[model samples]
Structures are given as C-alpha cells and as structure tokens.
Target: MGIIWSVIFSGMSFYWAMGGRLGVRSLGGALYEMSLNPSPSFLAIVWLTGFIKLLGAALLIMLLVHRHNSKLDRKLFYTVKIAGAFLFLYGALNFITISLHAFNIVNYNLDHYATFWRLAFWEPYWMAGGIIYFLSAKRT
Candidate 1:
C-alpha cells in the first residue's frame, strides 16, 4: 500500500517538475484568478523542488521494497524511517502553508496558492508512506 501510494505521488511530482498545470489554481474558496507569470527564478525553484520530491518518493519505494525483502537489513530500515520522516515533514509543512494560504488562515498572497492545489491533493499519501514506515519499524 505504501509503495503504491508513493508511486502515485511520484507521478504527480513528475508532472509538476515538468511544469504541468496541476498546480496552476487555488484549492480554497473564491476562485483565485491570478496570473501565473512568475519570474524565471521562481519557476526554476518550483521545478527543482518538484524533481527532488519526485526522486525522494521513488527512493522511498525502493527502500521499502529492499527492507521488505531483507528483514535483517537494519540499515535499510533506518534509512526508510528517516526518509519517511523527512517526507512527512516536508508534506506537512507544505500542507499547512497551502491550507493557510487558501483558507485565509494566514495573510499570504493569494498568488502563492497556485501550487497549493497540487500539494494539497497529495497530502494524504505524502504522509501515508511515513506512517507506514513508522509502523513497520515496530514490527521488525
């Protein structure tokens, strides 16, 4: 289940990394209609982050599979735990910020919400891997 969810998230991250339009709208109330014509630097950062996230998700799946096959591989288990924790943190931070921006919980510029929809959509799965990893830790 974790691997499946991670793979799905990796696909979404890949799409975002390729400058796809999944994150081009707001997910909160009041249809936000702002120009997405951001500076090149901003776009570059977004793409870079997306790519890194995609890679991380892929690595997560690989690590989990390895751990599954080698129950005695303590090192791989730790790696999975750490990686999952970090992924959880990353997604949690993004989720909080996006939710705040969209729901007007914080006074952030609405334009920033363009990427909110994409991240918000993957929030559940983003943390699912982490939770799975943590739970697996107790088993072996």
Candidate 2:
C-alpha cells in the first residue's frame, strides 16, 4: 500500500516536473500557469525538488523490498525510519502550507476550486500516507 501511494505521488511529481500537460483546465495546468510568472530559478528549484522526492520515494520502496527479502538489520531499520521521517515531514509541510494558503484566499473571498480540493483531499492523502509509512516503519 505504501509502495502504491509512493508510486502515485512520485508519478504526479515527475509529470509536473516534466511539464506534461494534463489539460488546460486541470489543476496541474493551473500550477504550470502559476509557474510561468515565477523566476526560472524558482521553477528549476521546484523541478529539482520534485525529482529529489521521486528518487527518495523510489529508494525507500526499494529498501523496504530488500529488507522484506533479507533479514532486517539495525542499519536498514534506521535508514527506513529516516526515509519515513523525511516523507512525513515533506508531506506535512506541503499540506500545512497549502491549507494555510487556502484559508488566506478564503478570507479574501477568493474561492479557488482547485485549492479547495487540494486542501480537502490531495494534500491530506499524502500526509496520511506519510504517517502510515512512519507507523509501518516502526516494526519492520
């Protein structure tokens, strides 16, 4: 389940990073539009971070698979825990930031459907997945 969630998260990040167009009216497209006004450095950093996150999630999944096949060692355990911690923090920070931004928009009477859905669902799903990873990492 963790692997599945990670794969989805990784794929979405990679898609956005690669400038793949979902549709002109899609949330991803909106993000791409938003990115256009930002400096190139900012866009580069965003892509870089997306790639880094994808790599991290992939590596974490591989590590877990390796541990499952072999005897779990202390080093592996700690590494997995660290990966889980990173996942949790990344998801949490994103969730909190988006949620806060959505609320701010609401205060100004700006109702963005995309932002609302993200606040209500997308971000929380990732954060919850991160929490699951953390809890699942504890014993294995």
Candidate 3:
C-alpha cells in the first residue's frame, strides 16, 4: 500500500508538473496576444500558480525517493499527504467550475460539451488517486 501510494503521488506530481508547464506556456501566449496589454494581476496569478505546482511536484518527488527508514522520510510523507489533499480539493473545485460553465450555470460563456466531458470522466481518476495517496500516507 505504501508503494502504491508513492507511485500514485509520484505520477500525479509528474502530471501536475507537465500541466503547469503547458499552462504557463499557453497563458503566456494568450496574455501576449491580448494586444501585448497583459494585466499585471493576471500575470502575477499565473506565476504564483505555476510556482506552486512546480513546488508540489518537487516535494512529491522528494517524498517518493526518500527512504522510509528515516524520520525525515516520515515527515516528508506527511507533507506530501497535505499537498495531495490540497491538490485533490483544488481539482474538485475545477470540476465544479467546468460543470457550471458547461451547463450555463455560471456568469461566463457556456462551453457546451467540452467542459462536460472533462467533468464527467477525466478528473475523477486523478481525484481518486489523490485520495488514495492521502489515506495511505496517513497510515505510513
């Protein structure tokens, strides 16, 4: 169970790293394209979010690589578990946003089936993995 939790956390960390990289790239491009008139607040938010994702990924990797025989490893596992819980909660919120957007339930423009597909199928597995990692890490 510990190994399984470690693997799941590691995998999620990798996924989040890649997602953060892509988001930074794409959002940067979009901000640039907006008449080169990027909002300072928007850019700041993007940078902050990207950094958090990168940091989370690094912490997860550190936790995964550290040997469990040490006290430090246990501490790292606790940190990873907290981070995993945050990630899963954030993912759940994202799914809720998607559902709201897709159903025209939010103030923004509806995305029709695009958001629906994401909320209905894709995000659950990631959320589940995070939950499993959190539970297993607690036991460890």
Candidate 4:
C-alpha cells in the first residue's frame, strides 16, 4: 500500500513538473509580447512565480522518491501522505488561478471552457486518487 501511494505521488509530481514547464513556455511568450510596453514589476513577478513552480515540482519528485524507498517506515509513509495532500491543494489553487485568468477577472482572458473543464475536472480526479491512496495506506 505504501509503495502504491508512493507511485501515485511520484506520477503526480512528474505530471505537475511537465505542466509547469509548459506554463513557463507559454508565459514566456506572453511576456515577450508584452515587452514592447513592459511592466518591469510584472515581469519580475512572472519570473519569480515560474522559478517557485519549477522548484516545488522538483522537490515533490524528490520527496516521492524518498518516500518510495522508505515505505516500510511509518514516518516516511506519513510524509508521503502529507505531500500528497499538499499537491492536491496546489491543484485546487491552479484550478482557481486558471479560472480567474480565463474569466478575465484578473488578467486577460486566456482559457476556453474546454480547457477549463479539463483541468477543473480531470485533474481533481487524480488528486482524489492520491488522497484515497494515502488513506488506505494508513489502514495497512
């Protein structure tokens, strides 16, 4: 059970890292377009956010790997569970951020309904799986 949760956690970390990479590329393009009349503060914030995201994803992957290797220990198991919960929370935040961006509530509209629904629904399913795996591993 611990091994299973570790795998799930690792998979999610990898998925998030890939997503972050794509976001960085897209945002870089957008930033380039805005550079003609650039806001230095805005550009700084974008770069900072990208760095944090990439670092967090890397940390998550490392945590998952460590957890997988130490699955026999209760402390490591709990650590994985906590990390999974954090990932799910991050997913929820990402959903909200995308929605805000798409709706033009904060930034210009960048998301369509199709992409919104895919992230809002499909992404949460994996989060739920991660939570379930954590809970079941506790039972074992």
Whole-model Cα lDDT of every candidate shown, in order: 0.57, 0.60, 0.54, 0.50
TM-score of each: 0.54, 0.59, 0.50, 0.42
**In model 1, what are the clashing residue pairs, if there are any?**
none
Best by lDDT: 2
Provide the lDDT at 47 for model 4: 53
Model 2 agreement with the true structure over 39-114: per-residue lDDT tens digits = 6665676577677656656655665564444455555556656767776677678667666767673232224766
Tell me the tens digit of each residue's lDDT in model 4 across 1-140: 43444454445434433333323223333542454354766556555555644553443344444344454555545655776687577667766766677667766434354445536564575466456535543422
If both were scored by lDDT, which would come out higher, candidate 2 or candidate 4?
Answer: 2
Looking at model 1, report the run of 10 residues with the lowest lDDT sum. Answer: 26-35
Give the alpha carbon lDDT tens digit for every residue of 64-126 in model 3. 564657788777778878766865787688678766766667744324443554565545645
* Residue 126 lDDT in candidate 3: 51
Summarize candidate 1's per-residue lDDT along 42-93 as a digit string, tens digits. Answer: 5566566566656655555555454455645666567667877976787788
Query: Candidate 2 vs candidate 3: which has greater TM-score?
Result: 2
**Which candidate number maximizes TM-score?**
2
Give the better candidate number (3 or 4) by lDDT.
3
Ranking by lDDT: 2, 1, 3, 4
How well does model 4 score by local distance difference test? 0.50
List candidate 1 segments past 4 Å from native: 26-72, 94-105, 111-122, 136-140
